[model samples]
Target: MSGAETEPGVLVLAATPIGRVADAPPRLAEELADADVVAAEDTRRLKRLTGELGVEVTGRVVSYFEGNEQRRTPALLGSLLAGERVLLVTDAGMPSVSDPGYRLVAAAVEAGVPVTAVPGPSAVLTALAVSGLPVDRFCFEGFLPRKAGERARRLAELASERRTMVFFEAPHRTEAALEAMAQAWGGERPAAVCRELTKTHEEVRRGPLAELVAWAADGVRGEVTLVVQGADDVPAVSTDDSSLRAAVAEREDRGMTRKEAIAEVAVLAGVPKREVYDLVHKSGPGEATP
Candidate 1:
């Protein structure tokens, strides 16, 4: 054989139901049954899903999640390089979208292994499709930072993003995330909060950010996905030092760092944040800023 190596095995990324088990696609069953090994974000959930789908998983199952993904990638790569068909699935949606499997996919690619996907249910696509927002052009932002300060900074950076944005948030933090969005993007921005998508209790609450925040005030539950309208082209606003300082101060009072505030103010005012930073610093620290 010319000493040429054989082609490596394939890595299959299978999408699981975001909520309703019925939404699981037909090809996923074949992949689960035929894969030489299966890496699941939650093995228990995998078992439950197989049972509900009336499918049997005959492959060796292993845990693969955010916590152990990096450490486990090498072993999975070994299996792939050894010509074993490995299938990856997450608790919900497709693997590697705010979930595990990215490492293994990357490793497999680097090793010249063929990688394929059995597209099925996805929380991101479902939310975006049903969001009634601008689907023509959109982006999935995954989850926002958990910490308040970090989350604020993240929102500020995206404040000027012209494409529609989607974010996943925990049930308990839905209210807070929406509140923060209202603060950063204005309350009147159109958005939809999709909860328990594809399930019996699935809900898609569509309205302005302010109204949604008030609705979520009492509490929100289940898998929460927020789809917010993108920023419209804003006419250049007055960039007087006093105005700039006040804008930065407003975000600061709300817990944003100076750098974060500058980035945000810069995007909003359509001016270079660096210029604002220099101007603000030139005014002296103690007199204008607190």
Candidate 2:
């Protein structure tokens, strides 16, 4: 009885539904009702969830989102130390997966507060489940960098990633992201775009990168998750400048014009125009222009 009287030092990081309220884990309602304090990414969303669960949040409620996590974590930690069972939840999915709650979790660990999760629906896994890709090994690359240059550099680095890659992007940026991926990962790479998983308008568009880019150009709305095929150990195509130029020069020898040859070789070798040109130029004056 004395042990039972002792305050709970556990920090609960609960997973919320990504969509469809009915999909929420059953344990969530009981946890919310039993917690001494609840830290939510959005209090209004929490309220809505509680309403749906028909569970009253007798605990004190506070906001703990990206904007206030740093400031809020310490306060929540203080509550835990005081023997309060402080629960952290995001608007959807697991907190800290491209969402808030990372700071609070770190703070709790430092403060020696025990932390556990009430695992629930996840957009990443949901998308991957329907992706039909090689998920035996996979990596989640949460939301790509927003800037075009940084995003391209990131994608270029991931070009050789051997595991399936999952990413989340806003509806508006879906097309641009797909296009950039096509440029970096080859247009033929297989991918899937999952939107509004488990919701009424749930959609999964699976195809080559080039086709996905074209599909996205028509505009996609709602939460978006992308699963891209990883680099297979297939032998690299000969796209070195000289190699491409040789192929292009061969095309030229066959009556194809310089512009036509460059474009054709660039497509065949799966490389950029500038890359093919450099190959041709480095071949030296006389050696170039077959």
Candidate 3:
């Protein structure tokens, strides 16, 4: 008996090169030639890719994109169950990464099928690596809401996010998105706009949010990945007698009662409420009262 006939079927998730055909890994070609079924986000693109790499897929090729992923998952799962090697490749990058393939992976996992990957190029990491921003701790925000109000609200929520943030934006909406980001994250926040990464005409623009907004005003082109620096760490406030009293007074003026003001001030200044209360009391009635 052959190993392919005896071993359990496997689901292989392959990552296609985002750009630059030479980036395709060897394992990708090997699996393409050996798999029983090849599911691609775009079969036409897959054909071109195979031609460019001088590799031929012996497996049956089928479309597995956003529109038909759910409908096609069952059949693909059946292939895996029948001891057939099924390979899943997206148009670019890894499957289920702000792209199709999540549903199929989840289904495969639930069915006890062996799922593995052929790791390759990614636009997210590629942009971050060359973004000239902090990469140690970062978050991928995928794509923001397309509507103006929803997008604004979303940006507002991330205004204070401390980890460097990465986002994907359409070329046409790049200017509008940057303007909104500038409004929510402050004009001076540092960021990098990477366009057409890993391809000819690739451009990376790094500057304050406002500057990028201005640069994109006239127009911009190509696939865009925005990497924005996180919010600056808030400086610790001195908990001296005067500073504490001033903090409490400031909150009190903003409509907080003396007791409420002291507690809030203590939290902000990283001191005890009792300490803030004592400072407020020591300032005398004139300065303590809002």
Q: Which regions of candidate 2 fall more than 4 Å away from where they truly are?
A: 1-8, 234-290
List pairs with backbone clashes in candidate 1. Answer: none
Runs in model 3 lying further than 4 Å from the true structure: 1-7, 234-290
**Candidate 3, overall lDDT?**
0.85
Candidate 1: tens digits of C-alpha lDDT, residues 244-268? 8878776676667788777778877
Candidate 1: which stretches are off by over 4 Å?
1-4, 237-257, 260-281, 285-290
* Number of the candidate with higher lDDT, 2 or 3: 2
Cα lDDT tens digits for candidate 3, 1-290: 64544455899999999879999998888988898999999999999998988888998999999999899999888888788999999888898999888888898899888999999999999999999899999999999999987787677556547899999999999999999988777799999999988899989999999999999988999989999999887445577878777766654544345776676567768888787777767677567543
lDDT-better candidate, 1 vs 3: 1
The residue-level lDDT of candidate 1 at 64 comes to 92
Clashes of each: 0, 1, 0
Error of 3 at 53 (Å): 0.8
Q: What is the alpha-carbon lDDT of model 1 when measured against the actual structure?
A: 0.88
lDDT score of residue 80 within candidate 1: 86
